[model samples]
Target chain A: MAEAAESPGDPVTASSRPLFAGLSDISISQDIPVEGEITIPMRSRIREFDSSTLNESVQNTVMRDLKAVGKKFMHVLYPRKSNTLLRDWDLWGPLILCVTLALMLQRGSVDSEKDGGPQFAEVFVIVWFGAVTITLNSKLLGGNISFFQSLCVLGYCILPLTVAMLVCRLVLLAEPGPINFMVRLFVVIVMFAWSIVASTAFLADSQPPNRKALAVYPVFLFYFVISWMILTFTP
Target chain B: MAAVDDLQFEEFGDVAASLAANPDATMVSIEDPGETPKHQPGPPRGSGREEDDELLGNDDSDKTELLAGQKKSSPFWTFEYYQTFFDVDTYQVFDRIKGSLLPIPGKNFVRLYVRSNPDLYGPFWICATLVFAIAISGNLSNFLIHLGQKTYHYVPEFRKVSIAATVIYAYAWLVPLALWGFLMWRNSKVMNIVSYSFLEIVCVYGYSLFIYIPTAILWIIPQKAVRWILVMIALGVSGSVLAMTFWPAVREDNRRVALATIVTIVLLHMLLSVGCLAYFFDAPEMDHLPTTTVAPNQTAKSS
Candidate 1:
């Protein structure tokens, strides 16, 4: 049964690892590999021992990727095809999404001026922490993906949440009644589910069949929290 | 039926006694599902009855037996029944309260803190107690002023006072409940996740109301300027706590929504604080005027 469960051909059953066992294994394996070879090569001039300037080729690639991300922002909603694109670490998409989320959070408040710094910092930290935590969990569960790659996938997965946030903002403009709430509620739920499914789809490949649920649980929580924040946005 | 009523009364009396014995014992351990609650600080507190029922297999018995047992056991509406909600440790409650008050970023500490410690009882009771205190003190102050006047003035209407207190207390939980429901609905709609339970939201809201306890206590001062200062402090502490707690939760791609949520929460907190001050603390003075005018007439008639 375990062998059948672990079989690569059985995608449906492969990731359904026993919850307690997987959790125990992850906790016990404290020395799990967290880093891999940097896939995106630096194309810039060496500026310092730690910091290097971006080379023209690398800069061009990033610019091109940013353009692609912009052109394919909608791909984040239906990210099955975008999985191939997410394989290359395009930090701009995540960065833009993070900024957008932060700005969305700052809307209509009296203390927006004073709150801007902390709000942005809070959003950035949460996103990075969530990505890192999910990455660590995946790695501990024998995930094959690199940390940066996982971060990219996780970051792009927030697009549905972004959409949900936008819809919530629009919905809040209307009178707050059951009908308006229902509409906001419906949009957020759909987007939140999309985000979870999308993240799981992209990230779940590396986990063993039994540990898959364990891996997806955090992702679900991450997106659900974001969706909830957006949904409860009462202006 | 008579036997069952006797049992019910006896159980109720025991629960009341236990509660009176340990008024501060808010923690209830639910570590063992099947076994009766053993770590309850005071007396056994009715879980023994549950264990007995389980042992008798009365849980799965025939309808008549179940009905008789339930009647004999008392309806599941007692304080002990709700004690399960206060499952988190007292130390953890303090930790969460601290975290919610000073929510530094990086790990989304408030969110994680809340997720880990999902207790509703401590906060619920604390808020209820604060509101109740404010209500009682307001009524007491009014009653005292009326006594000082020595006029057969209209006493503070018990019905109105009780209803007002109940409404204010209900608002403490009701608003949070509504927001929780909205958030859950949104979570289900958007992420298809029910991340925080209703109790967890209640827990957060309850802890957030900690500032109001002091404010409620200060309401009895009868000085408007001093009372306003206390109200401001209450609003500041509670508002900041809420902002810190909810910042990470509401932070999203849409700045408007996040700002709106924070503002709404703060405004709601302010509204409740101000409303408590306006209705419970300050209104007794206005209510005294009508009574003072009526008191002279009543005294004259009596004389």
Candidate 2:
């Protein structure tokens, strides 16, 4: 971004030399009042950073968003506590987990199709409604966390259990027996507990110690339900 | 920060005693603790704020209170009007929830904890938490019971959300409305009956249900004996709170009326738990070989 900002004129010159060159040297107007709101077009308003983001192709934008989503998922998988983790909140990670889980557990879609697992619509509704309920509980309990911030945290924390489900499917590929069942049980239990720890690590400081359980109980149930689903998956 | 004691918990104690003295500060003066037994049961914090103001002499707290006073004085339709309903501190909420959990006789739950400042924060939230708790646990128990059945299909029960919303909202809201109306009518007929404001009634009902938030989640246990036992324990604890709190309000009336009112409270309490248990949590259909085969899986986790 610093390079892009510094080399702003380079992009124009590389594409095609400006006819007069000085026309490109013109700066944005500073005479406009800076203190108040104005209805500037979005392109003009963000013209300064245009070279970095605006000139990117569709694939580049998607990749950037995906990279952000991947970083959050990685944080959940590793289960670290950092203030910067709380600063950025997005639903993309949760949405990806829901899709991934639904695809992995595709024994049957919700009576809709034969080939697909649980439909995306079903997973989407369950995840969002659970997240909304959990967020509402935290806010009502007088936690200082914002709604979507908690939602995104809870959503990303599902990463471990989703990963457990993936591992369970691979274990199921082996012959069904006592050994496989024990392996599945062990993986599901560990990841289920990990999911809880990751979520509360992110959310714990926001709630008071006494009332933290009230906010966290809903989070527990959210992952508990998914854990049960994973634990019960059959070959 | 603690100029005297190094103990950090002294702060919670200091704040707790001062908590009861806060809402009606003007009414409770130096001599007031000798008069009102209910508000002064704890060590007198009547002059604690004065000491703090003298030592810290921070106008920041005063400025915030002044801003709050301005907010309370505003008309009802503005944004602060609604926000102020949920403006209670975390300590006060915890104290109220504690009082609801441990219903000590001779001290009214509403009067000791709620009547002074009765906000809608607890009532609104406890109800919301119970809604999701039941919905999620209900679905989970269904899956867990059928865990090892090879042919059994898993479908997420989306309908439980709506059903939970309806049942929980109706009980939390409609019952309070009816009970408040009954109290109002009885107050007019009987001379000087203790009449609870509608919001206070709603707040008590709301906090009383906090036990069920944990209980509902535990209902995911597939064993019938454990589920019923949990329901009964939750019912007994929260039920005592409501019954004892309301006992004073109806003790003056005739025995039949009081008995009937108490019965209705107990009966409705039973109906909510048992009805929800029956409706949401299904009994195990069959205990077969597959379940036996996977029984060790459950045992393995426990071990």
Candidate 3:
């Protein structure tokens, strides 16, 4: 059966069309009635075709091919959705609360007056686990969590971090002073790297965490420079 | 309108096909018998030359008229600027929200961050966590100053310096925000939303400035009643905007992430503040600065 053809001036909605049609042919010709008719001479595309030879007749076969090719290209660009899961927050949230409570308890016992060592190692480990496990896994875990959910997952990680903090405190207690400061800095830097890794691997679908960090450092340096200048010049 | 230019689209398929071959094709539609029928073009029968000309003229005028109408609505002064700047995925989201419709992501919220666009959610989460971390740090510094003065020896100069440091830290936190906004603006790339990352930065910082700063400053108010009033207003405004944006697609892990970020920042800030205080107390005093002669018990504490 032959397809229906539109008359000289009828309008059609292209969006109503589907993704597959063997061949679509359209032409606009003005019937002058008395004088010779004028053919607008437009083009037609073969959206899909069972016969390869018919596809060659498409007005802009390359464009249609490119679009089809582009659509095909997009599918292969990212990882399969099933591998990355959305995590369960109910289990994760309370776990973090527990860890935070433990840390507060430990900090309560330590005297704030003395030079106690930093519990940086514990903080680092906690953050590492938190980022890797919950923050990273939520999407993979098959759940729709909010930004707050991300926070809760990280919070659970913080408990273990507090434990790490306790350990750092012990180390600081042994060594004391600027050495502890150095240790803390080292831990923060490590945690920062872990955050970057988590961002790239799991947060891959999300924004890049490290980009802001990079932007942040420069801004801080700029402020520091301005402040230092003011401090130096001011009477 | 129908009498005029109905003939123009008569060759839309052919034009689309031609354009498709050009490799710059934007959109195309296919007619499939397998799928349900939609907008089926009625049989084209009656019409004349003068009517055809009028239709063609109408289409031309209509195109120009549409463009003119669009230009009139294009000014950035409206709420659309906010929507364009803040809404991440769908402009339709902005329109719906603007229209005061409740936004609930019936089912799309189940997808993981990696599945949607790849790597987009990760950065946003990181940025959000970092923001929370900075806030906690400021809070921690405040707590330490309180603890140091209450529990141990109080040095006026040290207290002043701690205050100064806290102020600096608070301001420093805004840097990431500024950068975030700048990048979002520069990229003009929207991960899931219509607006880019820049919009997020603007939303975060704009809301922070309008919400957090005033709330923090109000704490200095002499009367609790007045302070609470200001706090309520700030919370209501900020909270509503956040809820409107967040609740539509709440992630289970987000709350945990936020908490962890808060705790880590608070603890780290505390450690730094105390460390700085300890350092200041122990360092030898120069002639220019006032010296506090340490008693034996105090000396032990300082050591």
Query: Distance from true position, residue A206, model 3, in Å?
Result: 4.8
How good is the docking of model 3, by CAPRI class? incorrect
Q: Any idea how many clashes model 2 has? A: 1
TM-score of chain A of each: 0.67, 0.73, 0.31
Q: What is the TM-score of chain B alone in each candidate?
A: 0.59, 0.70, 0.26
Model 2 over residues B23-71: C-alpha lDDT tens digits? 5432222222223322221222434333334323222232222112322
Off-target runs (Cα >4 Å) in candidate 2 are: A1-52, A79-83, A102-106, A109-122, A136-147, A175-181, A205-217, A233-235, B1-98, B117-165, B188-193, B210-236, B252-256, B280-303
User: What is each predicted model's overall lDDT from 0 to 1?
Assistant: 0.58, 0.69, 0.33
Chain B TM-score of predicted candidate 3 relative to the true chain B: 0.26
Query: Which candidate model has the greater lDDT, 1 or 3?
Result: 1
What TM-score does structure 2 among the candidates reach?
0.63
Residue A146 alpha-carbon offset, candidate 1, angstroms: 57
TM-score of chain A of 3: 0.31
For candidate 1, write residues B122-183 as lDDT tens digits. Answer: 46445545644665566554544445454323332323334554765576678778777766
DockQ for each numbered candidate: 0.01, 0.09, 0.01
DockQ, model 3, C-alpha based: 0.01
Regions more than 4 Å wrong, model 3: A1-87, A109-152, A156-160, A206-235, B1-85, B88-303
